[model samples]
Target: MENHNHTALISKLLTCVAACENCATECLKEEDVKMMAGCIALDRDCADICSQAARLLQRNSVIAHQYLLLCEEICRLCAAECSKHQHQHCQDCAKACMECAEACHAHHEPITQD
Candidate 1:
């Protein structure tokens, strides 16, 4: 069960990283980059944290629960930020962040149990 949860969570985290990266790149291309500064910053932060969470999960870290909780919170914040924009990339990133957060939440119990 833990293996299944880890696998799914890692997949979601990777998806989130990709989405966030793409969103940040798109934000850079916007005419008013300053207006998208917050979104861009959040995208980078979300991607980095999600990547770190995936790595820790891969290692079966004892502190995985704490990392997952942090990842979930960051993902939620990034999603909220992306949701305020109308661009396709932002919209897509928001969807991925939500998915990652949901998967992280699902995997929380097993990590906390042990």
Candidate 2:
């Protein structure tokens, strides 16, 4: 990836991580927390993947591309789940997830084995 794309991808990944964290906290504050089981689950998963992807990308690891793909997949799933909720946090998270997924798709390339 070029320097510009790398920077953009990192920015998107950080946004995904921030969104996931906020979503999880918001879910915990829901009056009907049980109703947010799916959202909470996805939030946790997305957070983990986004965090890992960001770390790998920061290191410029070759495996970062693969992690980016995984992050995109997880973000998409999380976004779909969040879209079902009416909470403001969920809406914001869904938007962030969509943005992250787009960035990931835009920069993702197949990893080549050395």
Name the regions of candidate 2 deviating beyond 4 angstroms: 1-5, 111-114
Residue 107 error, candidate 2, Å: 1.3
| Least well predicted 10-residue stretch by lDDT in candidate 1 | 105-114
Per-model TM values vs. the true structure:
0.90, 0.90
Expressed as tens digits, the lDDT of each residue in 1-114 for candidate 1 is 244347777889999999999999999999999999999999999999999999988887777767888899999999999999999999999999999999888766433543
Error of 2 at 4 (Å): 7.3
Backbone clashes for every candidate come to 0, 0
lDDT of 2 by residue, 1-114 (tens): 433337778888889889989999989999999999899999999988988888888878768887778888999999999999889999999999999999888767776676
Predictions in order: lDDT: 0.91, 0.87
Alpha-carbon shift of residue 69 in model 2 (angstroms):
1.1
TM-score of candidate 1 on Cα atoms, chains taken together: 0.90
- How many clashing residue pairs are found in candidate 1? 0
Error of 1 at 41 (Å): 0.6
